[model samples]
Target: MADAVIVVALLLVAASATAAVAQREPARQALVLSVLGVVLAVLFTVLQAPDVGLSQLAVGSALTPLLIMLSVRKVRRQARAKDRAR
Candidate 1:
């Protein structure tokens, strides 16, 4: 059971990472990273490392997603401004 969970988690992470790498749009890539981080947090919890899982949840899942969203928003704004200037 544990092994299966681990394998599934690994696959999920790998797939997400691959998708992120393939994505050309910054916002889409960020979204993929955020999803991957949350999936990793869940995998940590499944491995019975509550402390590590919580830390991952807070830092990777929550904070990372927030930062990515902020960056994406800023980038979009800059792109719009540049377009207007042209």
Candidate 2:
């Protein structure tokens, strides 16, 4: 029973990671990466490591995606400005 749940979590993490890698757009990749992070956190929790899970939740699922999205937005704005200046 527990093993099955663990397997499912592992599968979800693997699929999300593969999807993240396959994505071309930064925002899309970030979305998938966030999902991966959440799944990883769940897996950690299932494995009885709530501290690590909480850390992953805060850093990987939240901060990492936020940073990626902001970076993408900034880059896009810079690109638009460059185009405007041209």
| lDDT of each candidate versus the true structure | 0.84, 0.94
Clashing pairs in 2: none
Error of 1 at 32 (Å): 0.9
lDDT by residue (7-55, candidate 2, tens digit) is 9998988998899999999999999889888999999999999999999
Highest lDDT against the true fold, candidate: 2
Q: Give the poorly placed runs of model 2, Cα more than 4 Å off.
A: none
What C-alpha RMSD separates each model from the true structure? 1.8, 0.6
The superposed Cα distance between candidate 2 and the true structure at residue 50, in angstroms, equals: 0.5
TM-score, cand. 2: 0.96
Per-residue lDDT for 80 in model 1?
100
